[model samples]
Target: MWISWMIIAVMVGIECVEAGLNTLTKVAMTSGMSDFVFVVYSNSLALLFLLPSTLIYHRIFLLGLLSCTAQILLYTGIGFSSPTVASAMTGLIPAFTFVLALITRMEKLDLKVKSSQAKSIGTIVSIVGAYIVIFYQGPPIMFSQSLPILHSPSESPLSNWIIGGFLLATSSFVISVLYIVQTWIIKDYPAEMVVTLIARVFVAILSAIIALIVESDPKAWTLRPDMELVTIVYSAFLMVTIRSVIHAWACRTKGPVFVTTFRPLGMVFAVFMGVTFLKDTLHVGSVIGAIIIALGLYSVMWGKAKEVEIIENSFICRINSSSEEVPLLQNKSIDV
Candidate 1:
């Protein structure tokens, strides 16, 4: 019971960290920090921390490539949209991973089982909630009259929202694929830290190259001594290194779907961050969608727990049956 609670707490903590990251990154970008440059700098700084203990494998490059691509997409989306949108889009990950896992045969589907049925229902519900958040904007709710320092214009253009939503959705899908591949790699290597380090190294190199090309002005790479520097360091230490290591460990222990199950939790955290720090207007549709997403998240988590319990009970029954058979054979041999 304690272990289950610990897992839940840790997952919640990770989501909080992710929401904070998005908030900070958005603030820094609003201060004129190039998204591409930010990715390169933070990742490069992370490489320095990870370099102390490093092992290389050629196949791990794919992991790095995917990571870089996803980060670029996510940050770019945040530039165009709000952190709330980015967090909301993450709710799609479990649904995406569930489908990918089934396709890859990593997960089994048996509609007859209540657990599987719950998971299926939860996936559909989650996707519906996500789209509702995307398509519906009923009314904006303001918490305070004062505008935040980091807040952008009163309203972002609709085009930007559409583009950002598309990019964020794409990023989530890529992450789902990465989770599947990472799980496969971990099964063979079984070294979470080393795997993560190798992947980060690749991300740093690739992102640096892309940043150089996209940000032609040399001044764009220069970090200011203010929030720009702070965001980079925070992102490097907490997000790039610590978050990646924790996630890799979680993915090793629990399946990819389990790791992604907590994504909706980030929406709650993001809403808090946006309202307090960013002073982002809360929309009725967003509130409704987030609540629905949370419900779906709970349903999926319950289904996963039930499935685990069923597997464990079945294993215990098999062991008991074998033990009983052993005693019966011993009695038959003695009688003979």
Candidate 2:
């Protein structure tokens, strides 16, 4: 139907927009914009837009801390590595989320169930793929042939690449933790928009404090009249407002599974935009590792889908049995 098509279009558009902005941010940072300052500014702008939606806030400071930490790590990783690396690392979130859920007792692990076994195996495979990407650069499949100026200074060293990879991985893990916490918070505070606004406020304030401490140069807070300003405005309006609204709508209309199913597409967009616009090289190890991660991600998704299906089926059967028992009890009463 049209609704399904629209959802697909918007989800793909969201991924493309995210990839483009990531590339733009990298270019802006490469042009002397401080990563810390960028995070502070973008989040501050987001706060301005979300101010009108402020409804309530509970004891959710931890949400802000996690989000701020994740943003700092993510942006710093982009500065050290490339958008492609950041996108590739996102595939690890589900794997990390599953593991954390088990640790938190939010999810159970049953070795007898094939679904749980698949999730466990998928987690291991995802971790292995992450290691391979971090430890091995291999040869360039697509060398930088244009936009020579965009080549990241940090990318010249293997150690920086490894560090960037770990930072990105940690960022994804932090986001997974955020997801888990968000679920808990939603039980008490059902207003997602309010929770998001509160979290953004926290991120803005926290990031600003950190920026002031690390980037003491008053000039670092000053925005350039060029791409820096553009990136901030774009992030504030499109990334913060439009993207969030679309994702929330999609999740409510379809389901989280429908939204998450499109996540892998982000890496494709990142690779295309990075290679084409930023003239980033495609490394063999990154490709191989990404493919491996994708495989594991799909495996985990399948297991999750199966588990959900089984749970739904069991609930339906229970309801039907209860209904049948109700009729038999009524008949016995009538006979009496």
Best candidate, lDDT-wise?
A: 1
* C-alpha-based local distance difference test score of model 2: 0.75
At residue 182, what lDDT does model 2 achieve? 66
The alpha-carbon lDDT assigned to residue 4 of candidate 2 equals 61
Q: Which stretches of candidate 2 lie over 4 Å from their true place?
A: 1-16, 57-59, 123-144, 152-155, 241-265, 283-294
Candidate-wise lDDT, in order: 0.85, 0.75
In angstroms, give how far residue 237 of model 2 lies from its true place: 3.3
Instruction: Point to the candidate with the largest TM-score.
Output: 1
lDDT of 1: 0.85
- Clashing residue pairs in candidate 2 (N, C-alpha, C atoms within 3 angstroms): none
lDDT of 1 by residue, 173-226 (tens): 999999999998887888877898889889999999999889989999887999
RMSD of 2: 3.7
